[model samples]
Target: MGSHIGGDELAVSNPTRAAQEISQTIFSLDLGGISTVILNGYDAIKECLYHQSEVFADRPSLPLFQKMTKMGGLLNCKYGSGWIEHRKLALNSFRYFGNGEKMFQRISEECMFFCDAIDMHKGKPFNPKHLVTNAVSNVTNLIIFGQRFTYDDRDFQHMIEIFSENVELAASAWAFLYNAFPWLEYLPFGKHQRLFRNATKVYDFLLQIIERFTQGRVQYSPRHYIDAYLDEMEQIANDKAASFSRENLIFSVGELIIAGTETTTNTLRWAMLYLALYPSIQEKVHREIDSVLNGRAPTMEDKQRMPYVEAVLHEVLRFCNIVPLGIFRATSQDAVVRGYTIPRGTMVITNLYSVHFDEKYWREPAVFCPERFLDNNGNFVRRDAFVPFSVGRRHCLGEQLARMEMFLFFTTLFQRFHLQFPQGSVPSLRSKLGMTLQPLPYSICAIRRQR
Candidate 1:
């Protein structure tokens, strides 16, 4: 059931195929000394990650991750008090700034700019990747820096390009090998080299911003994450062993910008692809928006009234299954899932693709049917198996902000324009894998809607 992928590795690219290869839901691969346990079903994943959260909450510090983050960031840090404190601080900051009316206003303001950029396409086919990325990154930028960048800003664009390139490279098998074998770093050339180069550039870029924020008397009223962090660091300066160090700030901001930009931006791109693929679905969503607000810009309040639109978004998140293999987690202590023993420090991969497409949990899991999320009464029904963001104490911290961006940007674009495959050209829903499952670059015509 476990076949060698190549060179001392056993692999499972497709969850359903992997399940067929091995009858059990929980199976392990001995990648040399590294043990990777794949949790392939919904029940098994929930049992370990959701139920035994503390036991399986730690992120494994692989070689590549160690080199990239140095265990300073919130996402890939080992499970301990330091991780907890960093996560708590980040959560508090996000809640303080990313909640209630102001949050939606900020998102909507960016959404307007996004719609305007799309309108400039003027019904011609064009790649929406940069436009979407720019808008999404701006939302996060505003939250993290108390400022936004112009779309034409050269420095900002280069930084984002490098961040995305590194993510794609890091997600490759080469990077996995780099993590498995640390000596690869000593070699003169490889994708790892390029990844390291890009990472340095991105970090240096971030460091410059950090220096600007930390320079001189900190008399500011804590404008953003940096300023707020400075205030916190100053308050805790008396403690020499504080977790809020300068290194953590750089890594934390890098992780926030990289993750925050990638996930929501890619999700919106998927939304665009799906809308173009299914014209009827697009029409229904447009109808719902038109009926709900009558041409007024969509607000968070309007989301509740538009069940079909909500259903579309839910389906998009579930269907796309962006983070197919959710971020790797490791067992902090010995743990058991579905009667299988998972030793301490074993690499744990929650197959989110399987959960989202599990036949037992979803009907016609392969089909792009928003109706699956809609009840017979036409009310939006939530499913427990929809774990695109994964579940547990360590799930995506930006879930609220991500959801806001998707809804605001998604509906606003559809409200103003109809996205369609250009002329007679057809685009596939096939995705290119990376740190995130990104839709292959495609073009769509955004014809303005006469509402």
Candidate 2:
């Protein structure tokens, strides 16, 4: 029964109904030959991921991830002292580059370039996918490589396309089958093969960049993440257990590039789709941006004054629920949750989709209402169940940076243009399920807003 219910169908199908049918927040299943546990609802998620985070902190050795990552990078590395040191370094690096006035300036500059690219469309219908993705990925590129790429850089563009393709392939039915039966990867033809090929291409691109940086880099005068990581590798060269190495550095940078790019890019795309679908919400958001910024560049400081914009951004995160299952985790040791004993190494799937639409925590869970996030006085109110970044120790590493990018890019676009569907054509709101939930391909007319 577990094998029948827990295949590719589980990846694309709604797990909330299954949870309802079973009438349990926490349940176990045999996925292929692997023991797996699913966590549903806010309460169950909070108990396992937050209160008992350590026991459920490690990442599972899924076959696909094991093959691609070799259990070396920060995201999929086994939980231990090595992971601890790498995470600390990563957190500190993020703080250095992702916070304060400098980071705000960086994102605001990209917003200008983004709006300029859209202006090239001249208010005609065009899919925002490429421009939006380039803009978002540039921000991540700046953090990791100390520079940004022009929108026309074919190499950079190709790398982004590869990243996007791998994401969809990783979440496809083939990836699930590959994970269940590792031997299938040996076959010559399958989506799994494409997945491997894409990984190799991305790794090659990153390696070239790393090699260039290594040669030109100054010792201890780190220009970007790569330089800093190199310095760490040199210092820890003699430490046998240290996770810092050339190979790990490559994988770590790749993980950062993907994580920092994909989620925020899709969220921005979803926001535009939603705006086109519901013009009234877009109008309100535009009014908020205009009133708050008043023809000025938006910074993190302006976010507090724009309550409606805040609510809309939060709503987009909740409504879209990108990264719905989040990064899969494993038990560090035997654990008990709500009287259920889960053995050590059991795979844990956090049903973030269920939490976002959980009827108990939200009012009108199925509706697209940003107003739900607003108080009676029209101020934005943060919800307890709003875990778009997931929860606990292994939650999104780039959450702060992502929030900054979303707010600045979102407000900038709306402040300068009005998004609307092409005449007589309304795009479907239905999402394509990949590793992240993305809007179906849609084109919108971005008419410039005259003050």
* Candidate 1 residue-wise lDDT at 244: 80
- Per-residue lDDT of model 2, residues 375-419, tens digit only: 999989999988989888899989999998999899999999999
Clashes of each: 0, 0
Give the clashing residue pairs of candidate 2, or none: none
Q: Please, what is the whole-model Cα lDDT of each candidate in the order they appear? A: 0.83, 0.87
C-alpha-based local distance difference test score of model 2: 0.87
Candidate 2 segments whose C-alpha is farther than 4 A from its true place: 1-24
State candidate 2's TM-score. Answer: 0.96
Q: After aligning candidate 1 to the native by TM-score, how far in Å is the CA of 305 from where it should be?
A: 0.4
Q: State the lDDT at 224 in candidate 1.
A: 73
